[model samples]
Target: MKIMEYMKERFQNLEFIPSIYNQWGIGIHFCLGENIYQLKEKEELNLKRFQVVYEQITIIFNELFEQNDDIFLVTNMYKHKKEKCIRKLKVYQPFLKCKNQKCKNHLNQILVKTYPYPFEINKAEEYEMQQFSLLCKPRDLRVTELLKAASNEDFPLKPKFGGYSTDYPDVFFVNITKDNIFFIYDDRGCEVIALDFKRIRHLYEKYHDWVEEYKCM
Candidate 1:
């Protein structure tokens, strides 16, 4: 099945819907015909369903990276594992086509099911490990820059702190925030990428700030 179809099927099975709303009773938001964000205000079966949806999306993301080389993935390893570590993940397809039809050479490469993380994160570490595949995930570049700039000294925020994980595989998602954001980690506990929430929110805010900035200009 196409990856999108797989995700939609998974999403449909979860039966997730918006249960929470703002004070003004707004419960859902969309961008580019996608349900980019939602809030949950009530405790219902759908809450569990939402969690399932999130996990499925994480799995699908990993599959996409492993299947297509055209896509780029990066993640913040240190943020998730702590220490002065970071990781840049790349996905590769298993087979390459031969240019010569007469040669009949079908070269095959090892399909990397999982990218080994330096750390030793396992099911014993957290319940999340049980439900999702933690190895061989995808990441993006923002996390790479964060790793380059961060200090190597171990601090209290080391393990039980803000690490990295993005919601999607190909897209950028970093977990270096004080707020609660979504994340997916490698088997050894590495963030795939720092997410682009700041950009999203900045764009939202820009709509309001444009008038003031325009006046100053």
Candidate 2:
């Protein structure tokens, strides 16, 4: 088969793998390319027999893992927004106009909520030390459309940062790894949800190790 055909089949097969969260179905991320490359470089050729198939398949695998990981900030944004709706708070949006004057479009910061962090933070103040802006995830319909668009590709939805848009309200994901805390804010800069990173490296590794077992299946 052609390279394109091979990649299509590979990703389709990936859909069968269940999410680590709860046997929920989900695809891997697309940002793990560098990780895979590093893993390959670290391999000891003398101890292991490297094959063309393994190399080719892992290139895609690492990308999927990393692509799914964004700083914990996305989850924070969702929480903050939800709180405002509940209390009837006015959502604040920063005035970041679209650079295109004739385009009849403008942009602002938005935060989206996500799951707890994979690690912890010891220094809580680090999160407050700096402000950050994040890319907003596409809405449901937009996400669906994107999936459909990617379905035809060799590496469909090779997940990377999507471009800026007006819909996303700015937010922050705070105290990752440095100290085990997650702070989520809404479009209006209000604290919405705060949580601790439940997954320690040991725990996450235990779960991730299952992927090795998954490969056998």
Candidate 3:
């Protein structure tokens, strides 16, 4: 699939894989590519990054699983947003978004509500982390559309600072046993990390010249 065509100005790759464990990864910033089409300078590169990472993740998932295999999706749920609509007289999105009627039927129709987090001043709003996930085949949801649109809508803030560590506003986590792939879209650029060489070297080599240095992330 062809994304926008652009020239590389100062493309630098970030490689940091834990040696103590398995899961080595390499990533690049979106800004490195000069004159990218349809991307605003100040805005986060959501679709562009998703497009690349989705292809990689699906390929990796396919490598490990089978044509009929069901991969797991652990998408983060917005606690703040959930609070806003929790008390209203309507079904919460997690329930509504479910495709299985049987599953939806079992779920209680509860309105969304918001209760402030009670804790220290440092952690005034950093601990409300919840996720809605599914275990199904890749084709079921056409996950690209669901993720490209819903994830951002669900969790709008792409955490630049510290909030909920688990809740990466614009990041997507792909886990396979101990090995994992992190789709980090909020950072410098669209980066995909393959842990412990779980099949990421090729990705890294694909952009070898652009890779900069290895840091301790």
User: Each prediction's TM-score against the native?
Assistant: 0.19, 0.21, 0.44
Q: Tell me the deviation in Å of residue 63 in model 3.
A: 8.2
Pitting candidate 1 against candidate 3, the one with the higher lDDT is 3
- The Cα local distance difference test for each model comes to 0.24, 0.24, 0.35
Candidate 3, position 136, lDDT: 43
Summed backbone clashes in each candidate are: 16, 29, 15
Model 3 lDDT tens row, 1-217: 0000100111113212112112332333222222233344786554564455345444433443443443334333334433432221111233233566744542333212233443245555744534323444444434444334422333343312222333333324343433334443421333444434534555455655434343224
**Candidate 2, 95-122: lDDT as tens digits:** 1222344112212333222333222455
Candidates sorted by TM-score, best first: 3, 2, 1
In terms of lDDT, the poorest run of 10 residues in model 2 is 183-192
lDDT of 1 by residue, 1-217 (tens): 2222332432223211111111111111211102222233662222333333334334323422433223212222222322332222121111112244411221122111223332355632321110111111223122322221221112221112132342112222211221112223211111211123342343235333221111110
Which candidate would rank higher by TM-score, 2 or 3?
A: 3
| Better by lDDT, candidate 3 or 2 | 3
What C-alpha lDDT does candidate 2 achieve relative to the native structure? 0.24
